[model samples]
Target: MATFTPPPTDTMRAKLLLAAREEFAAVGITGARIERIAASSSSNKAQIFHYFGSKEGLFDALYAQTLAETLALVPLDAEDLPEYAGRLHDAAVQRPWAQRLVTWYRLERGDAAPMEAVVASNAEAVAEIERAQRAGVLPRTLRPAVLLGLVVHLAAFWSETSPEFDTLVTAMMPARRRQVVVDAVAALVRR
Candidate 1:
């Protein structure tokens, strides 16, 4: 007789995470069901509880992982704020689930501790902006944090804010929307 073996724990955990991400993105934390996640992952509810403790715990793990991935994929280039904003915009468009996850986090878990990596990365970007200001590359009138906030917001405008605006943009050619983002960022950051 052939021996029978089970799949690895890590593999099951990864599937669970992926299924959870899709579920959370579609319906958010409050609406997501453990049964559905387990069904989608080809695992059981007991395994999810064993791996993540609870639904909230699973969401927290997913949030942290998403934040780390975002930081790795979208590093700031303070010397070129326009380019940075464009890259941020592209990333937001490519991985829209990240934006939805953030929305869900803000709506459902406002009191949760923020991902440290995101905070640290934002602070580093602010410092870089200040350095660029001192070097006469960027304007010194705006506060560093405010400038960073504006750039980040502009990049995420289409994804996270204003469904009506998104509808209007959707009617335009894709390149036009992309150019609009690039031009807007350039205009905002120009000295």
Candidate 2:
């Protein structure tokens, strides 16, 4: 049903991606403007449709890119749990858009199979939890999925609602306080 066509130039594609990201970040998917995205990207609306098929298609591509970026920040060999938590905290503060985009996707403004895509994107995180479980790093009483959900949700919750989130929870707290909270969480998780 499809015919072959020349691919859009890399520069053009990059601009469109960047523009789409900004639009989605500002107004969310339901409110995003395809025409404005095209204008800002210096491409035509037709070009966007040609490349992405539809707004949903464009969203899928953008969501995949965002997930990849998030996964990259998570080190595969998480030797130091507190250090990894610190990294996650920093990322949440610096890239709040990342979680907000996912939240928008979860709200599901008519995208096909959006839930499936989100689960698929989370495969790497699930795998990390499994590895932690086998190594006894994660509590045996908790399912890997549950534990992983807790980690992500906890970070997201603090990032979104806590007035003191960035300055207190996410920032590199003074060394003494960092240990106090890290130990507190370790105790709670182990309980």
Candidate 3:
């Protein structure tokens, strides 16, 4: 007979974390139901507590993980700001999870700890921007945080949200117009 080995509990807990991220991104923490999150992970509420201590604890873990993951996606190379911009634009187009997680965090304001993840991530990006400015790749006057903000906040408007936004971008705008808008933003960042 083949021996059977159970998957590690941490592995199961990790699944819960991922499910929580998706759920919180969709529903916001206030609106996200624990049962649904559990159902998605094929776990129960008791297991959630065992892993995270509580729903709020689960939210904190999700928020931290989401911030870390999103920050990891940022391209901070001085020579590759354009590529970075393109990457960010593509992320907005491709991975809506980061934006949704951020939206949920902003709306819920659930984390009790200081937003250290944000400051750390931005600081690293700022260091990279400073390098870009020194290299004359980015404009000397552009603040890294401001540039990052523009990339994230503006791209988010187009990428996420109501059906109206999708209709306007998908059905209303001509292909040329859509391309033009994207090009304009890229040009603004490059200049």
Clashing pairs in 2: none
Comparing 1 and 3 on lDDT, the stronger one: 1
Residue-pair clashes, model 2: 0
Q: Which run of 10 residues does model 3 get worst, by summed lDDT?
A: 172-181
lDDT of candidate 3 over 1-191, digit per residue (tens)? 99977559988888999899888878888888899989999888988988889887898788787667655776555565545555565666666777777677766774456678667877887787777777787776657778756655544555555886566567544334435445654676665
Residues 9-128 of candidate 2: C-alpha lDDT, one tens digit per residue: 877777888888888877888799899999998788998898889887787788778877877886534334445555565676678787777777777654455446557756766787
- lDDT of candidate model 2 versus the reference: 0.69
Clashing pairs in 3: none
The best candidate by lDDT is 1
User: Can you give the TM-score per candidate against the true fold?
Assistant: 0.88, 0.76, 0.78
Each candidate: what lDDT? 0.86, 0.69, 0.71
Go through the candidates in order and give the C-alpha RMSD of each one to the true structure: 2.0, 5.5, 3.4
Q: List the residue pairs that clash in candidate 1.
A: none
Candidate 2's C-alpha runs over 4 A off are: 1-8, 76-79, 109-111, 114-118, 162-185
